[model samples]
Target: MNGASALEVIEAHDGTIDLMVTDVIMPEMDGPTLAKEVLKTNPSLPIIFVSGYTEDRFKDEIGDNAHFLPKPFTLQLLAEKVKEVLS
Candidate 1:
């Protein structure tokens, strides 16, 4: 889903959100911006950013709880990263 919809879902849900996986480039809002907003409410939430852009481009913008997954990654890699972050 797009950032706005994702934000809405986060706001509406009462259950815990284990992780947030978002693309760096998205319509309406970028992933980093979305992460910042999400953190305001869920500061401890973990985020995984998947993007075609180089990691250096946005690495500093996201905090320690966030991970960057460069695009063209395999599903296995994604799963592993998620597991790593959640662990």
Candidate 2:
């Protein structure tokens, strides 16, 4: 799930997913594409993106409901993001 394209991972899901945390600058089908496609099937799933890049640079790709974490984030921040998405 980590390195695979978001769509590949998403298509593999079988309704057990509650949240998806992905790196924004992936090789294929960036995080946004993955999340967007997943949302088409499961709109309620929470998505959190972690990237070293700026959000504005990827604004057009990310979904409106997606939360973001800038690069160099701490474990606490990641945990907080996950909690926030789930909550």
Using TM-score as the measure, the top candidate is 1
Residue-level lDDT tens digits of model 2 in 2-69: 44555776688676888878888777566777777778888988888888989999877885767889
Residues 54-84 of candidate 1: C-alpha lDDT, one tens digit per residue:
9888788776667889998999999999999
Task: Give model 1's clash tally.
Answer: 0
Q: Candidate 1: minimum summed lDDT over ten consecutive residues — where?
A: 57-66
User: Can you tell me which runs of candidate 2 are displaced by over 4 Å?
Assistant: 1-6
Q: Could you tell me the lDDT of residue 60 within candidate 1?
A: 80
Candidate with maximal lDDT? 1
lDDT of 1 at 36: 94
